[model samples]
Target: MMFRKKFVLFFGFVLFVTVAGAQDRYFTKTGKINFTSKAPMEDIEGKNKTVTAVLDTKSGALQFSVQMKSFEFEKALMQQHFNENYVESDKYPDAVFKGVIANNAAVNYAKEGTYTVNVKGKLTLHNVTKDVDVPGTIKVNGGKIEASSAFNVLLSDFRISIPSAVKEKVSNSIRITVETKLDPLKG
Candidate 1:
């Protein structure tokens, strides 16, 4: 009985370690987003701050979330209108993305290389969710991981209504870029 109990405890400890090492989560303090729209009069470019992402490497899954309230435009009036009317950031403060990496190939995180990843996930903005396919590059080097992606999203798909007054200022399609750093799982 004593031997059996010892063996069970040892096995349980090993199992815990194995499972704990499988999933890791990370976040970056500086993440950015860019937007562009063309009108008959002028072309506009805007940027946003405050993006966060969580990654589960063992499961090959990732989730990225951004606060819509953090989006900034050059013009104060434009920014205020964006938050209040267009994006409704006060109501839907966040845009979340949850998806899995489609590639079956295992990534050896210890090596230095770039891997192409097919990301399929749901992107939610303005309380609307749409399926998006974003192709990105993941680089693992010297215990550090870097990920980058650029994708286009249609504003109308997210039910973001544009007022006639500022229709020309905002574009129908928004281009998004993500840059993040990955850290190892902590104890």
Candidate 2:
């Protein structure tokens, strides 16, 4: 009887750990990120739908990565200039953000509601990394979490140089928007 009792306790502990680990992480592959450049000559915009993001609900840790080349611009020439001249996608293939939700404790992930949170992290672009704190919303509904945020990025901060000839066509700052629907990570 004692041996059977020990075996049952061990099995119970294993089950608890498995369930806890399963509920800690969430991920998404089809995240979308869009950016808009408002200049005097024209408004330039691009969208990338192949972003990958991961969130740890337990720790409020979040990270995302997007390929610079994956961004699609309406004008092919604009896209070419962006990749070759501005961002240099060939040299810097990906842009990434790794950060945590600053107000994680205020968010109750077990309940369904929308929570406004400030995310503090480092954004790497054009081979430059900068610390950023941006306000964003996290919505928990039916076991899924949706996160969205919009922020502006300065080109000079990332060391992206705009040519004197076309500087008027592109703005010094760009508006960026990110959205993702994350499901629980599967074992």
Candidate 3:
């Protein structure tokens, strides 16, 4: 009886601490991410609207999760080739980015203003991880926050090679954009 009671009390304490720590966190499940490849002969575009993201204000930790197959392309054939040949959705089904706000202390989350910030983190896709330093903005308004960033990356960096058939037509650099509005967690 004593062991069981102690275990239950310990579990309760851990749960309380976790919930307390999460009060300063903000999260959204419907974040948006878009990628564009503007090439000489062809332009490819894809958008994913079901990205899940979490940001802990206290620790400056931010993370994003996205399913590889969730990205939608305008052409069905392109989408099929993207999953089967490019990203291989069956083997590597998710892409994640875990980073921290470099200027966490400068931004006042309680104030209604927009703050420019730098985020440093690791982006993992297609079983490859790369370090990225991106410029972004954090907007605090009406007790809510909106975050956005746009950056260019080389497809080859993640071992994603453009197929020979379209190699000459596609650009090596691809532009990526992220946008998300987050609400504070209430516990």
Candidate 4:
């Protein structure tokens, strides 16, 4: 009986360790966002250099963050405007998201499958914080995991003051896209 108890304990310990190590980390140095506005008329898109995403299978937890200063556009002047007047990247250098997949057990990272999940988290930009619910797609194929999410942020929510000179040139909403390859977390 004692031997059986010891075996059970050992098995349980191993299971715990295995489960803990199953979290996956997917990262990218280039994440993109595009903004389009009418009237004054402008098209803007930028890429960030530091982006990290953490996914936990057991808990269906997802956390992501990016450095605001990393955003770079084709035009140097436009990029400067974005950082200085729009995003104020120097002041609010990072944007973070923390949430869980609504359907925890429905996603299987080990096999090829597509799962639609609702992600709820706080998004901070230009020193303003807002709660958001975003829909995302998670696909696991050939031992690789790809996560994609698109969300919109309102300029007013972030307190980004639009200058009267170009008030109509910028859009009130900004669209963001996140994509990356996930790597299994180590013990």
Candidate 5:
């Protein structure tokens, strides 16, 4: 009888841990972010594929971190000016967003479907942080979750300024797109 009780208790504990570990958290390291600026004279774009992100499906919490200098531009001069004059990557090497999903309960993680969610968070870039609420989609397919969103950010909001010499070549408003496939974090 004692051995039976111990076996049941141990099995229950293992089951509890397995359920807890499989449901709550998701993470990704090779996320991708793209930013584009369209102006009268130029269309500039930068892509970065080294983003790190985490999501807690149970608590609606989401976070992202990326290196500022990781963005790659098509032209060398534009990339140089972007890091040196605009974002100042040396001083602010990282950009982070920490926020929560406003209506996280609407998404049924157990089901395979797409859910639209509103993410409310603070975006920090170039040493400045601002409140941001964006619409994002979470697609759950084959037990995999794909998160994607696109939003526009003003350069001046992050203390990023374009020099007068190249002001016409760059737009003050930049559109950023984020994409990532998160994997279940298992212990």
Candidate 6:
């Protein structure tokens, strides 16, 4: 009958949509990023919890965006100097990374497991972009994907300069750690 054929077609369309949506993408708005600077005179640390990240599960593509002013430091003066002088947040408001997982075939997204992979991307900070390859871990647990990485960024690479007066208080390289729990994108 015509009604029976129409019902079958509608059911097939819905099933196709559901399957396509399941593998679409994953994203998070409240990711966490931390940076630390260690020197003989002092240790400086800052944290930003307002980072946004997206991962395309079907293509192994990953991207992140972080506002420079969102980073909170322990000392108010240090934070002020960081934005106004070092990072120049007014000119370069956000830092971004866009790239893909190099070893995508090793991980099974449907199954629950932790996989170590290499991420090659362009990191843009303080108006400078650099290509970097870093080791990261992707953990799939309970239908959620958690991606994390720890890496070092050199100040000179981003054109960040340290004042001579406080040169001893800061490190030339900063240690950065990123962690995010991503959920499937909903339509």
Which candidate comes out best when scored by TM-score?
Answer: 2
The C-alpha TM-scores of every prediction are 0.83, 0.97, 0.88, 0.83, 0.94, 0.93
For each candidate, the alpha-carbon lDDT, in order, equals 0.76, 0.95, 0.91, 0.74, 0.94, 0.94
lDDT over C-alpha atoms for residue 106 of model 1: 57
* Cα shift from native, residue 184, model 2 (Å): 0.4
**Cα RMSD, model 2:** 1.0
Find the 10 residues in a row with the least total lDDT in model 4.
29-38
Give one digit per residue, the lDDT tens place, for model 1 in 1-187.
9999999999999989776774355456566766766666566666766677767776678887888777778888877877888788778898888998777255655579998888888888888888888898889877678878888888789888778877766778877777777766564
lDDT tens digits, residue span 96-152, model 3: 999999999988987899999999999998899999999999999898899999999
Ranking of all candidate structures by their TM-score, best first: 2, 5, 6, 3, 1, 4
**Candidate that scores best on lDDT:** 2
**In model 3, which regions exceed 4 Å deviation?**
1-20
The per-prediction tally of clashing pairs is 0, 0, 0, 0, 0, 0
> Number of clashes in model 2?
0
Model 5: per-residue lDDT, tens digit, 38-81? 99998999999999999999998999999989999989998998
lDDT of 2 by residue, 1-187 (tens): 9999999999999999998899888999999999999999999999999899999988899999999999999899989998999999999999999999999999999999999999999999999999999999999999999999999999999999999999899999999999999999978
Candidate 2: C-alpha lDDT: 0.95
**TM-score of candidate 2 to 2 decimals:** 0.97
Candidate numbers, best lDDT first, in rank order? 2, 6, 5, 3, 1, 4
Q: How displaced is residue 7 in candidate 1, in Å?
A: 7.3
- What are the RMSDs of all candidates, in order? 3.0, 1.0, 4.9, 3.2, 1.5, 1.7
Worst 10 residues of 5 by lDDT: 17-26
